[model samples]
Target: MANSDSGASSNNYSFKVVLLGEGCVGKTSVVLRYVEDKFNERHLTTLQASFLNKKLNIAGRRINLAIWDTAGQERFHALGPIYYRMSNGAILVYDITDEDSFQKVKNWVKELKKMLGSDICLVIAGNKIDLEKQRNVPIEEAEEYAKTVGAKHFQTSAKLNKGIEEMFLDLSQRMIERAQENDLQKASELGRSSSMRRNVVVVDDEQAAETSTSKLTCCGSTT
Candidate 1:
């Protein structure tokens, strides 16, 4: 088989993805839904920011995703660049019931583009589908904005655990493809080897257990 000749050609990719939205809009809930595979109705408002790390093996490539959840309060807005700098992707989330949150998501997308340029894999998520009856942001309108900004839009419900995985998986896959393209471009420009470095994998037993049971939070400071 032609696949046999490919051997075990595996490259590991570590991607940083930030979740940006207003407080009480379920940004933390969405992160927990993806990383812990559980939902909490009484989740406290996140003060500053935190992150969670998950590893996935896709087509012999190990993708280590660090999902950062940022505080959407305007006071903490200044700290955004601290987390999103060097990020490979970002998910601009908004509450379906809160029109204001959608507006905030728009501002975020604009800022990200101005600062990070067009390469940051972007996605817009209209969250809280479980409360669809209360939705104030129309799906068509959000989809149109997403298309205008060159990003994919998804309707998600952290409470019901809908569309959470698909959003993350799609973003991760896109990041991988983008990385491959950049690698190819650099190789052509520099006339250097097109090979990628091996990604070191390490996980301690206690850390792994904690990640499963504890809140999905990671690298960032509290306000």
Candidate 2:
């Protein structure tokens, strides 16, 4: 979700991203590690859905990410769209040790593409690379799937903080580029429409706000 409330005068580009996966795939762990730089040894459960706000300065752009962590239990599967709908990007996590979890990620990829179309950015994270000795999903297979679906694949470990930063950074940059392209297309369409009509039409300036670089901040909440 782009910041619908932001005006043309603002400089913040807000994007909503959702995390999806099976239980114990470490979706919340990944978010906590990236946003708060903290990791918990104990297992955590997300009830329905919760979101954390992360502010990032990527290539001189102030990107505000509302990273949503949703429950991965089968009971909560029905509520997936409520959290993911209108989201700009998605991180589908799967424990490398669990082959079933990887299958679940594929299901989500199909559902997201069917509902949101190809415009939504996707990242398939084979998490818990630290447990490589017990890995069940092959790295090459996962990469191939991601490539076929037009999504990026990564190996991430919240415990060791491996690949967390790089994955989010890559996703953020992708979203920014997509948003800019959308704005340009909208501007072009508006220009053509204006040329066709001689009368001046009042329009809401829905373009993205001005952007600037900023440091990441630990600001977030759970719902």
Candidate 3:
């Protein structure tokens, strides 16, 4: 899974990260910035979930991110759980300029936790950071909510690409560490199972040897 060309030992860690929030919250914009390093100003509402891929190296681990941009309208909410299930992590986005969008973050978090479990890594991203004059959700308030839910918080401007890469990079590092920890746990369990099997085989061999020796001794004594 390591990328040989990067000169650093890179393991290809496939991680799914979904964006959830109310409509027009710049979910797709944030994803496009992270995946393509480009931004579009004419915002279009997302109909279905859109997927994008990006590769990066974090602490020598090659992480491949599968970004899912889900439609935030109420009608499309039924598909929300399906997207959440496939995600190892999530970036819950809200427009900094819109209070209603920001308020819906709690709902998104609730649904995600209900479907994906509390262990799933979640990041609360306050989008449109560039629109400071129109900002309705204060940074402090948004960050406090993020802390309350145990999710990382970021203020990003997709149009400006500010904090976009950093957010994804942070997620990548966390995902890589999680994957490594899980791998180590599995390896340790396998090693223990193998050792137990070996011990059983050795005990059986010793018991068989003792039985053979006992039979020989009996025969010799009788003769």
Best by lDDT: 2
Candidate 1 collision pairs: 51-218
Model 3 lDDT tens row, 2-109: 112222133666788888999999998888877777788798789978888888766666667778889999999888878778577889999998999988899988
Tens-digit lDDT track of model 1 for 1-223: 0011111233778888989888778889998989999898896687789999988988778888888999888899999999888888999989999999999898999999998897799999999999989999999999999999999999999999999999999998888877777766655755433232234457899989898655534432321
TM-score of each: 0.81, 0.85, 0.81
Report the lDDT tens digits of candidate 2 across residue range 1-223. Answer: 3442333334468899999999999999999999999999999999999999999987666788999999999999999989999999999999999999999999999999998997799999999999999999999999999999999999999999999999999998888777777776777888899887967755545422211111112222221
Which portions of model 3 show Cα errors greater than 4 Å? Answer: 1-10, 195-223
Supply every candidate's count of residue pairs whose N, Cα or C atoms clash at under 3 angstroms. 1, 0, 2
Error of 1 at 181 (Å): 0.6
Q: Each candidate's lDDT (Cα)?
A: 0.84, 0.89, 0.81
Cα displacement (angstroms), candidate 3, residue 109, comes to 1.5
Q: Stretches of candidate 1 above 4 Å error?
A: 1-10, 192-223
In angstroms, the error of model 3 at 116 is: 2.1
Candidate 1 C-alpha error for residue 58, in Å: 1.3
TM-score of 1: 0.81
Better of 2 and 3 by TM-score: 2
